[model samples]
Target chain A: MKSDMSTIVKTVTDFLFGFIIIFGIYIIIHGHLTPGGGFQGGAVVASGFALLFVAFARTFLDKKPQQLYGLFESVGLLIFISLAFLGIYRTFFYNFLANSGGLFGMKITQGINPGYFNTAGVVPLMNMAVGFEVACGLSLIVYLLYRGVIEEGEDGE
Target chain B: MKTAYAVIFMSILVVFLFTAITTLHPMGYPGHTEMDDYFIKNAQIEVGANNVVTSIVFDYRGFDTLGEATVLFTAVISVVALLRGVKKDEE
Candidate 1:
């Protein structure tokens, strides 16, 4: 009979999901200058979304969310690949954005200093793209599984 | 007899896993290093990314990440294909 968690769990999930997602975005954006990257950050974000799924399991049957998840996943993959393809004039994955003095492009001083956000060329963009792709991809998987399992349960009932 | 066999199998597996973990080098210092040294030294300048692991994963070895994405995509596709026929009303 129970589909969703207790109210306390729902309240905690509501409070934590936003922060979890924000932290994931931070990890993705700071990937070039920090310890984590797109995959790790995206996984973090997807975990947050997964928590949301668990908190409201009964309401996920709507097909719209699943379609949206698929759309986002496809878009992420497309962007990542296109970005890679953009550097084809030089190489497959060339750092075309480095030192260009444009968006996400700034000259880096030799040796280590306080890291600049704009110094890492195409890395940030790739990180963002991969992060989006991974987040959506993982969210889709979890949502689909939830749907499948829940539907199976309903059939039995 | 079944319990004895299960225990013996589990103990052997545990012993193997324990040896694998214990044999690993302590944190920070790894067993082999020429590649790691090069990457650490050059990734900053080469890829302009401070995180060497990220630089290596996304820049140097981008194909691997692409493959990973493909794998995930394939998984999603298969999941959708399998579940598409299940009607919402029927359930």
Candidate 2:
């Protein structure tokens, strides 16, 4: 079936998808200092992909196999759980790297001030992990749903 | 008669919803705020993050987030399984 939308949508998606993805990444990485975090940012990125799916044909995105998304989803979850387990010796989900002068370790003054990026310990890492998981999972779902519709259309024809 | 009954039911429902909305606790003034106070005061020092909500979600209350991730994974798995046979020729 001809699934692609009009040229207007395609052009808009081409211009906007990159900015959307970048904004989502910013939200995910700066989650420690900002309002949005993994789930929110991932949803944002997946929405960008959804725009692509709606604007383009199935063949456009079919270059990559579906399993690749599942792999990313699994890897993201693994990163999250492993990060949680790493702090098991101290306690489950302990802030092991906070204020330790390690990677993502930076002390802040105790009052309201502009927060540094290289701080917050495992929180930012976990944000990235969950961000990856949510983004991949949502995009996979959208892709499958659209493919199902396309398959039904073909069968009907 | 049916129209009268429908209007009466809708009026009662609207009254109930309006009362509930009007009686809600004022924003940022919950009856119990000790836990909120603790989180607001100590989240930055303990988690070293400016965003208290992120710190709480990722660090203090991480188990819940784990459950949330599992739920998303399960949803994706179910979708993939259901859609596996969509196009056998392509497979």
User: Which candidate number maximizes DockQ?
Assistant: 2
Judge the docking of candidate 1 as incorrect, acceptable, medium or high: medium
Candidate 2 similarity to native, TM-score:
0.87
Chain A, model 1: TM: 0.94
Global lDDT for candidate 1?
A: 0.85
lDDT of 2 at A68: 85
Candidate 1, A12: how far from true, in Å?
Answer: 0.9
Across residues B1-91, which tens digit of lDDT does each residue of candidate 2 receive?
9999999999999999999999999997788768888998888998899999999999989999999999999999998998775446775
Please give, for residues A24-128, the per-residue lDDT of candidate 1 as tens digits. 999999999999988899999999989988888877655348788889889888988998999999989887887788887777766877988987788898889
Q: Which residues of candidate 2, in runs, are more than 4 Å off?
A: A1-3, B1-24, B86-91
Checking candidate 2 for backbone clashes, the offending pairs are: none
Interface RMSD of each: 1.4, 0.6
Candidate 2: chain B TM-score equals: 0.70
